[model samples]
Target: MLLLAECLNQQGKSTQAVPYLNQVRRRAGLANTTAASQAALTDVIAHERRVELAFENKRWLDLVRTGKAAEVMTAHGAKQKRKYSYILPQAYNITSNRLLFPIPQREITLNPQLTQNAGC
Candidate 1:
């Protein structure tokens, strides 16, 4: 189902992606997709991935792949800080430097030619 939706989304067929998206939503006891625009549908798919795959270790990768890690994480961090005083107020500041992870130190040590990613 998601494969079909992803294909349609990639083809700029967000309207057609609705059915497959809705299939996932319905199985999760959520309502059908009512997203009107491609961007909105894209948001729906991202959200669905977050909810459906929570704690499976894919959320961060998904957000990063979709170029939404910064925007989503910043808002999520702010909300967390606001809702819980115990939570640190400092939120994740997503920047270009953060888009990719630094090269592993072990790997870099093994290969002297390897350069560390910027802002590690």
Candidate 2:
């Protein structure tokens, strides 16, 4: 139910997603928030998902599946660079090609038709 709500919200159907999100809030014993706009609702959903699923190793996959990898990671990278001078600027350069896993060299060698993902 939570995942369905998130998918609907991410796809710009926040109105339709609200009921599912509310259901999740009720189950989790959290209060449902009233967002003024679609974007706000989307943010609320993302925040809930982040906190609810913390330390379960789901964040990166969620960001990538929702097509928010580049935008979120780029901003995170900038913040880290500013907060810690030792952090390299290029450490989190999240280009579109970097959103996917690269094909293994062994797999590609075994299958001539297989090609590596971009930015591998």
lDDT of each: 0.83, 0.87
Residue 70 alpha-carbon offset, candidate 2, angstroms: 1.6
In candidate 2, how many Å is residue 101 off? 0.5
Residue range 1-120, candidate 1, lDDT tens digits: 765786798799987898999999999898888888887777778778878888899888887887878988889888877888897655466677888888999999999999998899
What candidate 1 gets wrong by more than 4 Å, as runs, is: 83-91, 105-113
Window of ten residues with lowest summed lDDT in model 1? 87-96
- Give one digit per residue, the lDDT tens place, for model 2 in 1-120: 778887887788888899998888888897777975878887888888998899999999989987898999999999999999999867999888888899989999999999899888
Q: Candidate 2: RMSD over Cα atoms? A: 2.5
Number of the top candidate by TM-score?
2
TM-score, cand. 2 vs. native: 0.77
Q: What TM-score does model 1 achieve against the real structure?
A: 0.69
Error of 1 at 79 (Å): 3.2
Candidate 2 segments exceeding 4 Å error: 9-16, 105-110
